[model samples]
Target: MKVKCPTCQNEVEWKPENKYKPFCSERCRLIDLGEWASESHVIKGESFNQQLTPQIDEFSEDLPPADEDFFKH
Candidate 1:
């Protein structure tokens, strides 16, 4: 089977041997990663922060209070 690379739109052979099957090459894969990392590519939906903020706020009071040594083990 063959499909277009999601990052470069180049034709790619879909096979287990192709490490970057969905991308044309490592460069294309990295480009896609950079886009997502920089927020250039975002899925359409309610922002995750927006969705979680209310839940977090509701539970904040139940969490143990933090201190300088909170994370110590």
Candidate 2:
């Protein structure tokens, strides 16, 4: 089968003997891997916060008691 190398976009003949089936050669395959490792190729996905809202404690729960008679005028 005929396939284009994902890195160079060059047409290459695919054969069972070629270890890098989709890629034209080892160089191109390694280049593609390097790009991914360096974050050049990023996978787009939703954020974790958007998927799950965080649980927060109520603000009133953190305050001292209002009934304390500290101000005696």
Candidate 3:
């Protein structure tokens, strides 16, 4: 089957051999990545980013120190 590239609307073949499936070329894939990196693409809804960061830091601090036995397991 064939599908249009999400970035450039070029036709692309849907196949296992096509590494950049859904994109016509590497250029189109990278362009999509750039859009994501620049925050040009965002999901609409509630954001948990602000709430989870401090919880992660707190959890990491609570972890026990690693010793030689840690690797043996």
Question: What TM-score does structure 3 among the candidates reach?
Answer: 0.52
TM-score for model 1? 0.52
Worst 10 residues of 3 by lDDT: 42-51
lDDT over C-alpha atoms for residue 69 of model 2: 34
User: Candidate 3 — which pairs collide?
Assistant: none
lDDT of 2 by residue, 1-73 (tens): 8999998898989989988869997757655653544345321223322332232112112323342232121
- What residue pairs are clashing in model 2? none
Candidate 1 colliding pairs: none
Per-model TM-score, in order, reads 0.52, 0.52, 0.52
**Could you give candidate 1's per-residue lDDT for residues 1-73 as a string of tens digits?**
8999998699999999888778877656654653554455421233422534354332223333342243232
The per-model lDDT (C-alpha) reads 0.54, 0.52, 0.54
Write candidate 3's Cα lDDT for 15-39 as tens digits: 9999888898765765565355445
Q: Which structure is stronger by lDDT: 1 or 2?
A: 1
Question: Candidate 2 versus the native: TM-score?
Answer: 0.52
Where model 2 places Cα greater than 4 Å from the true spot, the runs are 41-73
